[model samples]
Target: MTGGLEWAVTTDGQAVTLRQVAAQAGVSRQTVSNVLNAPERVDPATRLKVRAAIESLGYQPSRTARSLATRQAGLIGYCLARHPGRSLFTDPFLHALTEAIEATGRRLLVFTAPEGAEGLATYADLIAQRAVDAFILSDTVDGDPRHGWLASRGVPFASFGRTWPEQGEQPGRWVDVDGAGACAELVRGLHSAGHDRIAFLGWRDPVPVGAAKDRQRGWRDECRRLGLPEQAAYADSDSMEGAAHAAATLLDAAQPPTAIVAAGDLLAVGVISEVRRRELRPGHDIWVTGFDDSLLATSVEGGLTTVRQPAAEITATLVRLLDAGPGRSGVLLDGRIVSRSSAPLDL
Candidate 1:
């Protein structure tokens, strides 16, 4: 146990060690370490073989061993409590992001922390434990305290949503979909279709989320520029029921909107429901569009026209930025508008 044995399989069959994994993969101990730590430096075929061997042997490296060798944990931290239901796995975008990150060979260290002081304490504990080399911050909002806390600690971190400039001297390394631009395009198309009154449905929270603000900004700006009547509605939550109430308000207004553009798919679904309840046709009597192009977008009677965020691309960019270290400009990937029966395609 004290010699330079590097690794050995235990008689209890409780764990697989590096030495046994190397033997199985036909590689040396150093090769296995390189494969685990800096896989880019390892040959493709060799890395594949080593990974296959590790999987077959059910091998999991000791955190202490890894830290002793590389002085860093081969883990990426992510927070999930900020989402609607605190279930990241249930959301397709978050799920895709998690899968893409894991596909690169790094394991995730997910933590659920309530907002404010409690969340800070949770993050501090994770850092103190050296649980991860860096973190991926998602569901960012304006004046996010997590940014200041992590930056003050000099921890390597990147955001899946863009941070405001006021949060830092420069918006930190992050990747986000161009929600504003995409929403603007959706509004422009609706306006061209002779829809004079377009309503916006979005989150009604006091603390504005960066992504949601950008989306609303795009909708408002485009409407003002086109001399269209802007009707903005907000929902206290992202659920279809909340959206339905908001959409109903817009529908029952003195001058109802001919089209609806929601900040997210759930809100858009709510608008579709209201249209259906009133026996109005979507993509004809009232055009509707939403962001994220979630599963519900296609599940509806007339598929909702929505903006499709490239989750895989966003995850890949975030990983690259995190690997390169700090001071990188934020990335904004375009979300293509998927025209469907919910929104008209003409013009």
Candidate 2:
């Protein structure tokens, strides 16, 4: 291996060509081109042979030339909704989804867009510049204009969350974890563990079409069905501090709950903090559970019992949906309970 595809030389110090690679692999010139442009269309055995020959000869395909031939930049776009004081890195689910995208061998181009109308212009500019082949939209809301806007522009995109019921008529591809279902499952597990007074900690703004509301509804419905006392509380934010304050209030109520299930891991951490502050033993005196098995769930002194969303699977499904383009129905995956020291594990 002479190294460096651009400066690589043959045994006699000559530049390599596609024809030479095809000949060395004992394949047709068209086969070599297909392997480079659309490997999925080529037989796996032939694809490997061509790849090995290219590596052996250090032949790098011309990116610019290939782009012109295929009209594909091989890039997937993701837009982050920038909040006033929040960083995108704080979302572990996003990190996992990004990892899954990276594994697909497509370059990911991320952009930050302010919420509301300002995002419209950003989307236009990205498309105008031909910066990406498709986009991935997460945290979808009811009547999400991004979906409509992208549809009007005929831009291929996929969402990690499903569209709201009102936006059911909209055209787009989407995949989401069944957050509401997951929460209901948590309630069932806790009920089996002999916990009757259950409290739910969630975000303050429960948009009718947002995933947070979906999860909250799940908890409420389950509590009602099980004939358990239902107490609902809201946190200003998903941070530990916000959750801690909310959890404290829930505990101070006249009839405090024996168990708390937060919508996210960060909020659950806050509940645990308050439980400790009040001299209450987590998982014993008061069981706490959280959704999204984030790093904080396991890194803490006692592991948190939470629902683990299949981020990797969601990512893969989103890519397939985007590749398949719009008109295909969205997908919803189930999340499983992850037992830890914070909650009972038998169920």
Candidate 3:
């Protein structure tokens, strides 16, 4: 293959052309073009003959020409949100997403857009310039203006998170992990390991929307079902210090929990830090678990028990939704718990 596309030379070492392939296949030039661009429009027998001619002559269609004819940029746009201390390369989800997008023979156009009106304007500019055929959104929140803005314009896009109820009837597809179910499963697993006193450390969101709410709900529901104290749950900012303070509070309470389920890996690290400061073993003295199964979760001193979001599956679903066009129903996929020394399931 030449430049990842089939290229064959004639016996005289001249580059093959569509006209030549058409003559060899005994078809008109338009027929050959239809076979290359819109194969479904051609009869099956003609398509086979054209394909044979293409293969025999080593005729490679021009990607640029096809893109121009179809008005498609063959690119998927993704806005990289600026997280203060995080590197985009370190994000496992984005890595998986990039690979998936590339696998479809399309490139990912990574860009930056500051929050609020500026971000919306950036998206509009990309659309106006035809820089990308569609978009894949992440870090979506309740009443996200981008959703309405894009949907109203009939733009093609899919989100990695749910379109919150507050957004109200926006036309787009989304694929999100079932945070509540994952947290509930963690609770159940911890309960089966003989831990009744469980506490949850989740991010404190002013609006209590999206992942934060869903994950906390799982812990609350499961605790209630098992007759465990649901009052141990605490909310704080999504930071190590915030989690450490919350963990300290939970540990100091009268009848403190023996186990803590943190909403993210960073929070789990904070809990572990506190556990170690007290000269207590993690799994032996106080069980700790986290979500995201991130790099931090695996690199922890003794490893961390956490929820593994199905990144591969999530990206695959997003691609499917994008390919199927807009107005498709959103999908919620479940995450599985990854057990480790911090909270060994074997007790």
The candidate that wins on TM-score is: 2
Clashes of 2: 0
How far in Å is the alpha carbon of 107 misplaced in model 1? 1.0
TM-scores, all candidates, are 0.80, 0.81, 0.80
What pairs collide in candidate 2? none
**TM-score computed on alpha carbons, candidate 3:** 0.80
Please give the distance, in angstroms, between residue 28's alpha carbon in candidate 1 and its true position after superposition: 10
Which regions in candidate 1 have their CA more than 4 angstroms from the true location? 1-63, 86-90, 165-171
Candidate 3 deviant stretches above 4 angstroms:
1-63, 84-90, 167-170, 206-209, 232-237
lDDT for position 54 in model 2: 91
lDDT of 1: 0.79
Candidates in order have lDDT scores of 0.79, 0.80, 0.82
Tens digits of lDDT, candidate 3, 134-196: 999887777678876887898989988875655346458888899999899889988999899
Report the poorest 10 consecutive residues by lDDT, candidate 3.
1-10
lDDT of 1 by residue, 1-347 (tens): 21333355454576677878889999998898887665767989999999999888877555577467766787889887465652222376667767766767677788889876568888888889888888888877666778667877789888877556464454457787888899898888887877889889989976346678888999999999999888988987767888889988999999999999988887788888888889999888889998877777889986989888887788888888887765757778999899999996663
